[model samples]
Target: MKRALLGADDLFPTGGEAPPWPGRLVELDGSRLLVRDTPATAPGAEPALYVHGLGGSSTNWTDLAGLLAGRLEGQAIDLPGFGRSEPARRYTIAAFADRVIRWIEHSGRGPVHLFGNSLGGAISVRVAGLRPDLVRTLTLVSPALPFLDPRRSSQSRALPLLAIPRGDRLATRLLTRVTPEQMADQIIDSCFADPRRVSEMRRLEAVEEIRIRYELAHYIPAYLSSLRGLVSCFLRAYLPGAGSLWRIASRITAPTLVIGGRQDQLVDIRVAPQAARVIPDSRLLILDGVGHVAQMEVPRVVARAAVAMLDEVSRPDAERPPRPSRAVRVGVAAAKPGSAQVAPA
Candidate 1:
């Protein structure tokens, strides 16, 4: 049965109190994925897909998806072993990318406006590079691209732990000591520039989500294996070969918008410039006082920038603005209203 689209009154619940969008299990290539649909508010809205970062679920895109409902009918997927999805056979980036490809193919939603964060950004890069025909435009939020000398973030420190033997056990033991509420606080501290920006309701919601995920048997293995897989990809990303993400970025034909936070602890903001430089047709936006999750930190600003990109792309070849010859840096001040400043790189 087809579900009714959310009306304007239902779109943005008071105090962001709306629960997650409705989701259904989808069978694709012998795997089941949980997908949450945020129906478009307009009749001719374009199809879009949202891929969350590692350790995140489809709910990560809730705010951003709701904000973009006027322009995009979005589907956010739970990669196997995360959210309500079943466990996967493997947790490698390629495998995850393949699953995303399968879903797009299965749904016949090719050439979609693709949005990804952190690990999902890495996966989306692979998808866009490998199958350009399936993507219309790309937006990455602090994508976990290869970083040779990764910044000394908490996440970087955890990488070594994942490399150790029986790391999953060690991780399990460590996680056992931390309550879901504490875990949520740690995540907020690490992912946001200022922890105070997170509402108490959101914090409670995060704790509840973490508590539920803790009960799942596959959660630990999935997280540890995925981290290890990402580390492996990092090591392999710099080797002399056509497989490097840098090389892949050069091959992307889609007009891309790369957003990063100046205060990002996990993925160094320095890499954002390099990412924009490598992607043939891409622009960069660096938000001051924002952290790893720009989409979540400033959905309205992200939405404005995203809508701008969509508008530019939808214009005819003659009407479209000329592509900037060099990288353009846009700085949005603490997501304040009308505080975005654009300057030539």
Candidate 2:
């Protein structure tokens, strides 16, 4: 057998050591959230927070956080009900946004640079719009804005809350008996391009996730109720994101970066222009051949883009509210309004 670069024995450095950083629990609106802080690894490091999307835990940002910590004090939180955090009483976008806001306040890092991906991106956008004072700048990746192209398939992307089997009784029954592997497989597949490529270590991690979900299954009814409320309140109507994104985006006062991938199956790149147009100070960047997972697909590019957005405003000579993001390439004509074509971004 070949020597693995990162062998099991090298899993973590051990000198009977304290973790380089410690994770703490914060109370946000009655919900306990898992938060970890990476102190200034450099002479002077700015503060930043990484928010994960629905069905994702803070682990999603672990690799990126490590890289970012080199330049800034890094923080990432497991939103209520995801990761190590307990589920929130209500799991709506607003609810999640409120949780994030509270976490920021709890961290005592005022006006921190906040980066979010997918659903996290959407919530970050909303929070920045309503509470710009708390946010120094915003970075969004393949944000899950409501681009309801009715023609596309929803085979892979399933919001665990929304994916709860319909009807309370059936869902309760299934939740009580379902295996963690079953839940983890569906959850992992939804985020990755190919489940076969999910890597062995991640597979092991999924085992723990499954165990957690199983333990929490007793709250299936509550999750279902929250799921319904979220879909009804935010996902419906002529408005988007429970119909708040456009309004929120239009009012965003902080400098912003809107990024997406050309091949994002869930969120079309076409949405980037509208995001640019709405966020008074936002710039758009569209990466090529990437899926919805831009951070995972191209972390360096996304991080560089985020740093640029921050420096765009942070630099003394830099101006405010940069010209709308120039990276948006109009998507191909597939889901043209009223046309039956399935648009490909």
Candidate 3:
């Protein structure tokens, strides 16, 4: 298949000179946006649904969106409190999954393929497990599973979200002063294995949006509470907490593709084994030197793998592709210097 691409800045054309978007405001859950795209503009002709991590809006997937859009129609959401989406009253994993279901029902795009990064990955897994009927297949990039080794600094930030009483309100007050650059930096550090590849422009965009988020909500307390609940799903044991999605992984019957960055500090290398063990009919790919946000860190490689996985899922049972080996699965997706071939050499 031929690769589809819009040179760099071309993919993200919002407002002043942004690329023409596929659809705008299909629906508004409060203030957040439900964005959609079609392959008419994208190159690959691969249909997909993407989910971003915490504190991220659909914009986070801007470039990735355009890249994937080339293959097929694509839709991405700004989960409550993260992007243009307004925070819900409660931000639990199940609640987020509900919103995903709502979008699916509302869009009449049932059985769509799923892809997610970091916290988004956690939510994707939950949605697939809970609503297997809705997903054609599951693809996770640096899914935010709990750290076998705790991230002290990050843990401090996430703790209140899970355990502190009314901590969301306090978190908002504390983080309101957070700049988008700071937000971007933290995410880059936490999510990418090799953040150096993150362009200056991507950092700036994230910086701007993070600042905008603080000003959007009027019910600061509730928003904070809901934000906490949403993150708690990712921060609690196994990132979504124990018996949540991690436990659900073993029961997932979906054809799954799991990718992790060797550079990801948020969710470590070991988690891949856990995912491989639990997910039935699954393939695991670990991109070394890549971080939690492998998709962004190396869009081409990640996007290619994604399209291949989805395309495989879409094939007839007789044409399904073979599984990938652990050797082919490990390493940095973008920065590494080798092909990940699955067949015997």
Residues 1-345 of candidate 2: C-alpha lDDT, one tens digit per residue? 000011122222222212224578877666677887766556777888888765565666654555566566888887676667876567777788888888778778878888888778878987888888898888787776655553342522324536555665666566567676666665544444434434445555656755775567534554455445434543553453435677777878887778776766565667766677677766777665555665654455566666555555666654543343245442222211211101111
Q: Between the candidate structures 1 and 2, which one is better when assessed by lDDT?
A: 1
Question: Candidate 2: where is the Cα deviation over 4 Å?
Answer: 1-22, 150-169, 172-188, 194-198, 218-230, 233-243, 317-325, 328-345
Q: Write the per-residue lDDT of candidate 1 for residues 253-292, one digit (tens) a residue.
A: 9988888888888887777777888887787777777888
Ranking by TM-score: 1, 3, 2
How well does model 3 score by local distance difference test? 0.61
Residues 1-345, model 3: lDDT tens digits: 112111233333233213324546655455445575645464545457888775555655555565666555778777765555555666666777788877887778877788877667778888888888888878777676554455522534455554668665766776767665666666666665566676555555556655675676543454445445544554555544344667776767788778766765656567766776678767666666666665666665666666666666667989854543443543543443111110000
**Model 3: how far residue 240 lies from native, Å:** 16
What's the true lDDT of residue 198 in model 1?
Answer: 67
lDDT of each: 0.80, 0.61, 0.61
Worst 10-residue lDDT window, candidate 3:
336-345
In model 2, what are the clashing residue pairs, if there are any?
Answer: 81-86, 81-87, 234-242, 240-243, 262-345, 283-325, 284-325
Q: What C-alpha lDDT, on a 0 to 100 scale, does residue 260 get in candidate 1?
A: 80
What's the true lDDT of residue 207 in model 2? 63
